[model samples]
Target: MTWTDATLEDLVLLQRGFDITKAEQRDGQIPVISSSGVQSYHNVAKVKGPGVIVGRKGSVGTVYYCETDYWPHDTTLWSKDLKGNDAKFVAYFLRTLNLDRFDTGNSNPTLNRNHIHGQPIKKPDLPTQQRIASILSAYDDLIENNRRRITLLEQAARLLYREWFVHLRFPGHETAKIVDGLPEGWTHCSFAQMAQYLNGFAFKPRHLGENGLPIVKIPELKAGILEKTPRYEGSEVPDKYLLNDGDLIFSWSGTLAVDFWNSGAAYLNQHLFKVTPSVGFSAAFLLVAIRECMPVFMGKAVGATMKHIRRSALDEVMHLLPQGHILADFNHRASELYDQVQLLRAQNQKLTRARDLLLPRLMDGRIPV
Candidate 1:
């Protein structure tokens, strides 16, 4: 195996992506690669498969490796030419470059191709690059497998929830009587009746720090973990604003979503509600109930700029309360599945940390392949 020293521009051609508006985006399987990974799916692909993308604007230096054909959004710079370099190897190499340091903008960080083009880079021969990528991809493949398993487990649990609650086909349902389109003892009640929504605190920008309590925002809620959220260093942070693992959080403002806070201790930011289920209502039940209400909440959301769900909307949302024994049974069964999901998520976090630590070292030849 051999290596050669060269500039980035010599190894690949970087071209700005095309502008695709949200209105024009049709739903399909082709990923829409933005500055921060796949943002959405589009029917048409702007770039071919086995491509590498670099964040040129908002999320500067972020790199993505797409195995399938994708539509790279205008906010990114996609590789128009690899110049015979291994695509996956290029992705890894870019990560080792610390492209963030090449930001050309002061206020809003941005990456300019011309600036990065001149930077020196070390490249290994095709076979050696393949070997390095294979080692790293093995970890990625395992992570992906775990993710699929987690999704399946979650789906199975959700299916059981629907079968028992939505379809009214629980154990011994043959003798159960129905009234008002519900099981004999089941009652339709407002969300407020079953759960208490502790709205997050408003933390000012000045109070934020590099090291402190992670802020759980809407994005964090969507991702089921905190990523790139700001942190706050305040001993005065009220107990109500602090979060715990397994806590059910609902993003009531922008992009309404219900998720478990599997990530460790964090501060709950405004527009999010840390929901605590009342007696007889299990966290599992609350999660499903809130998820069922998402469509209705989204429909009622109002905003000229960014749509948001109001507290009033959540207050009006209804849940079908099951009998005590039935709710307990469901919680007992689903809790195991939820625990597995959390375990898998935690495992992925660890795998990610290990892979990330190995990435730069392997790419820079600090750790041999």
Candidate 2:
């Protein structure tokens, strides 16, 4: 089946979603599908779902599909005409269409319902469409499976760390002399005791660029890991903003989770902090422990204003120390798993990059489907 079989005219373009008002956007259980992705709040009535959704306005060519009930936000367009293509198939086909080609509004460059519905997309027959979709979907399945496996591996490592460190269960627990039921050599320590937390320097928004030194920001921290990063040149950063690799980056002001950096040299934003694991301590172990203890910290954190975990507050909290031999053993075991997880994660990242690069070529007739 060639793309010549289907045209944009064959696609039945549904009207754009109704404008979701701000007031109605909150306290609703509906998923607000916008140009970006699923967002909170709702104002518009939902229509045909478990189908393809394309961005008709703000982000002219962006494409999205849903497997469950969803309300399209005003910034996007929904298909009214399935035109024999499986909703999923059409969604993929639309993704291949060059959005820039269909863009009309010079200032906004939007694709309204009329423009998109009338657009030409050469689609294959239904069976062929399904077959192509199946092929592409297999790749997607592998991607999703890799994601789930990574999550499970990470969770298993975390659970083991919690059981040993948080629960204080180890080889020495039974035989070590006990004081108040804790092992004789074991004692409580603060986060400051185990790691020194250093805050980053300030940089105004204007000085920041998109492709320079990787800047770790507060909003980018999640689950004791770094996700999105801001790029800034070293020249742009103040002398104090520099951070070394192996330093655990933390969102000191907003989020409390700490993420370690084993990548190229990077800078930390004002709200970010660096945690230097004390001598003989595993930075990875401390990061996992912080994540495990965040719930307890959140519960005890006090503030009507923005909730945050201050260094002083963190310093006062007690850290349960596992016996030396036990801690070493746990670190050795968990480190092995973590190293493997990291390797798999790196491979998955490479795979995803390769797939994303190939997607456009495959979608367009550039690379034969």
Candidate 3:
């Protein structure tokens, strides 16, 4: 399946996204796009779907294909004149192409319709295009399914954590004494009392390295796991900030989130909060507890420019600290469920990585699909 003598102009490029000014917008039925992608929204006056979209400026080269009707903005370019190219196949091809190579010199890099129109593409015949698209689409479909499965597993874990820990409905609760209407041995304590918390010191962004220990950031602490582990110099991170396996990292700012680090030494920046379970405490259980209490603590935190969570203030936010026997019993019961969720998540990560690694090679015909 070797492609020869292929030119990009052979495949038509459509650059007709309506440019609607903010003031001119009045519940219009279209989405305004600029070279940077979708800039604003308008009511849909017309509809087009199952086409490819690429950013024409600023953040150029990013590509997306849609199967449902979408209004693209003037900043973006929509491929309507596909010229017999499979929309998905074109997206894959665009992704492989370095659109930045065609950038016009400007403060912000940009690519216009003419630039893409003149670019070259090494492509095969229609049947080959369909086969290539089908192979890549299968990988995407599997990756998407894994994403949904991860969400469901996380939701199930969160729900169970809430029911058993937050609601104090653990087994044998009927026999436990009722003290102040709460479960017999349960006692509420502040986050400071239950866990040791610390925030990492500021390190120069340039001090970061690509292959050292992970420097967990706010973005890494989403969906209860670490999605990336971009590294940093061991020196930039103080020993105090360095984390051991089983440490829980919490982001106290926007969209409050948490992640568990079960890997090698890693550190955090000033924006992240690290929590180590107190001696004799269950780290897994505490991870869930922190997630449960985050909403309450985040609501009380104050700042206009950026939300702040004072260590002193966090020390005051309360949580129920159940007595020893009950705590151990709850952990024992929930242990299997948590373990299963973690296993599934690990497998999903592997699948996602495999798919991503295969994408470019498959689309470029380096690997036969």
Candidate 4:
């Protein structure tokens, strides 16, 4: 296959996205795409899909591909003309440009469409483009499938938790008597009593390095997966700050969330807590308990801009503790479900690494399609 050098403007049309405020957005199926990805959903769509979206501001140079009709926000630029080019291939090709370098402003990073339109890029003929896209897309499809499976497994486990604990409908519930809206053997207890929250070490910026331990931050917790985490020098990292797989970590500041640390050995950063279950509780139970208490925690969080939960919040949050036998049974069942999620997540991490390694090689013709 032969490749030709061509400018992006020669192959496609770039147009600014529409503006839609949060107040105007209504709940629906159509995704409202921003520079970072889908910000929300709306009932209406301005652009039809299989379309490619490029970040124009804020998160400059980021690229997103939507397979369904979507609403592109003003912070992005979407393709208006493919000119017989493969849409999937265009998406892959865009990533190779490292578009972030073309930032037009000094302070607020921005991508000027005019600059990117004229930028030179090398691409193969349509058939080869499609072939390359197909190969790379296969990996993404597998990753997406694993994500769906993980969601289903989590849902089933959460439903079981609600049935056995919340609804007081455990296996032998028929024989148990209800008192004060609680199952006969269950007792109310504070979260602090069931688990211990270890705050992360405060590492200065100068302490970070290009190699050694990766630092898990609020962004990692929100994504539910860790990638491109900044590294900290091993010598500077304390023993207590190190993390292990399946450990539950909660972000107390900025977007409160709870997730298991599936990513291999890393250091927990400040504003996060490495939650360790006490003798009577399990990681699975603690995860659900923290998730259920999120609304209350959010309400109590104090801050004008970035809300933060105080240490006192943990003491105030309450949970119903089941008897040892019942709790053990619940843990046994939920642990199996959570273990599967961790396995799937680990598989996705490998798949992502493989895809990233292959993307540039495939795009540059180092790996022929």
Candidate 5:
């Protein structure tokens, strides 16, 4: 391996992004890339394809790669020119520079692209740059494939659920007599009747600590616990609020959703509920049911800013339940597909960790390309 001394500007030139407001955006295919990544689409593009964007304002230091022309939002600084260097390699190398350090000493933290260019750093040859990018990209490519597979698996389960339950097209539906808009041996029950919806305990700022159970909130359900996640190290939390693997979690208040907790032990936070299946219900069935009715839940939610579902909404959303045998049969099929989704998610998690660890080492040439 060989390295040469060069300033940051010699390899890649960073420039402030264009400004666009949500109201000005129109329906189109171009992504409105912001500091936090793409949050909307626009009809026009400000930067050409194969661009690298770094967060300049909020979510400072985050990096994003785009393959197609994009609208870089004002809160970011994007690579205007790669100066013949491999784009992916530059993106990875930038991550090692700790650009977040430049974000301090301001009321609103921001990264200054102009101020960061003069520092001298090592530069790998073009061949080495391409090789390093190839190696790192391999890990990310597989993770992305697993994510696609996970999405497909979840979609399959959701569709099957809708067909069997929502549409009342279960296997034996042909022979079962329709009694009062439902098949025979079926009962309509409230959402609460089928599951134990225990809301998470509210943890104040004082309860936060360096270690313990990571607090699981509504949005936190998907990412699980991360290194920066706040944990509850204060007084002992009740046994009921502690999350276990495969526990069904529901965000009832804002952004209603259902997710299974696969990450390690976590303390459930307010606005979220640890849902447990009752007598004849299963996690698989409940997941599909809640998703199908999410629109209704969203409509029922009331608030000026942070819309939330009232507890009574659970009683309002009733589901039709079939005989024990039929319910069990559906659960068995759905769980199989649901299990695959969880497995893929777990694989992606591990791959992400491995890639992050290998990143700094590869950038510094510790590991031979």
Candidate 6:
């Protein structure tokens, strides 16, 4: 059977998302889908699910799929009408279009509905749509399951860190001595002392290419190295800037985050800190500690346009450190958890690459449903 040659309008109707200010938002479970996926949550949902969303403002053509009812924010374009197409299939099909090419802005890339709605797209019939979606969704289903497991594992690690470090509830707290609001054999350590923060060297546009070491920017940090991520084919960037797998990455500016790198070695771009624990510090400890410092870092971030925490913030935020014996004991427990997380993350990356490779082949009819 031949697939129909049609415009995007024939498959689905894309409309500008509704507007909702941050002040108007309240705590809830309904995801507020923006151009960058789910950034916030709302008490009420604006659209029914499952929905397909394409970035129209900031992220520029990035695609997102939501399973539950959600509010599509002003920065995105959501499918108002599926037009009898499988929603999941439409989501995967849009990914193969390379919609970012439709960007019409010079400085800030933007996606306009009018520009793409009349564009040509080859789509199959309803039955084929469902079959393709089913095959692809099987991959998604496994990815999502692993994602939940990762979340639970991370939560367990965080709780363990907090319980032993913050709340002072530890294995033998009953017998521990306390003095001047400090436990015996405990001393405060600043964030700066805990790890070495090596900011990545700034690389220019011409440095990027289709091959070589993948560059690690804030976007790549948030969403690993995606299909569209820029690569550096140039000469040796300084050794300090090359980050290996399982290294700690701290993005001090623009959506502050602390996470361990799961992808293989990549070039570290500016606005990212490649953190290495000090001689006495452990990677697992700093990973959790830095995450806990996010609120304080956010409070000190200074910028009207783009908020960012300075290096001074690291020195300002301090935490109590136990003696070597206690620290080593904690590291032993945390390392096991961190190792499990790394294993799962590495597995997810392989699964993602496999699915992404299969998607274009399946969508292009190279692999029939």
Which model scores highest in lDDT? 6
Better of 2 and 3 by TM-score: 3
lDDT of each: 0.85, 0.69, 0.70, 0.88, 0.87, 0.89
Give the CA lDDT, 0 to 100, for residue 49 in model 2: 64
Give the residue spans of candidate 6 off by over 4 A: 25-29, 105-109, 202-210, 226-230, 233-236, 253-255, 298-316
Candidates 1 and 3 compared by TM-score, better number: 1
Q: What would you estimate as the lDDT of candidate 6?
A: 0.89
Residue 259's lDDT within candidate 3 is 69
The parts of candidate 4 lying over 4 Å away from their true place are 224-228
Residue-level error in angstroms, candidate 3, position 249:
1.4
Per-residue lDDT for 1-369 in model 2, tens only? 455644475865566776776666756556788876676755344865667777777767788888766788788877766766677777777776666467778778677666656665565666766766776677677777877886887788798876776676666566668799777877888877887777887777776767777776765444222324567764755666677545677775656666655454667777677777787677767778777777767766656676776668677777788667777776677667667666665566566667667666655656655
Tens-digit per-residue lDDT, 288-308, candidate 5: 888888898888999998888
Instruction: Report clash pairs, candidate 1.
Output: none
RMSD of every candidate to native, in Å, equals: 2.9, 5.6, 4.8, 1.8, 2.3, 2.7
Distance from true location, Cα of 330 in model 1, Å: 1.8
Question: In each prediction, how many residue pairs overlap at the backbone (N, C-alpha, C within less than 3 A)?
Answer: 0, 13, 18, 0, 0, 0
Q: Tens digit of lDDT per residue, candidate 6, span 202-278?
A: 99888889899899888888878887788887665777888888899999888899898878989999889999899
| Residues 131-236, model 3: lDDT tens digits | 8888778777876776687677667767877777777676676688887978777787777776777886687768666767777667556532243455776564
Q: List the residue pairs that clash in candidate 5.
A: none
Question: Which candidate, 1 or 5, has the higher TM-score?
Answer: 5
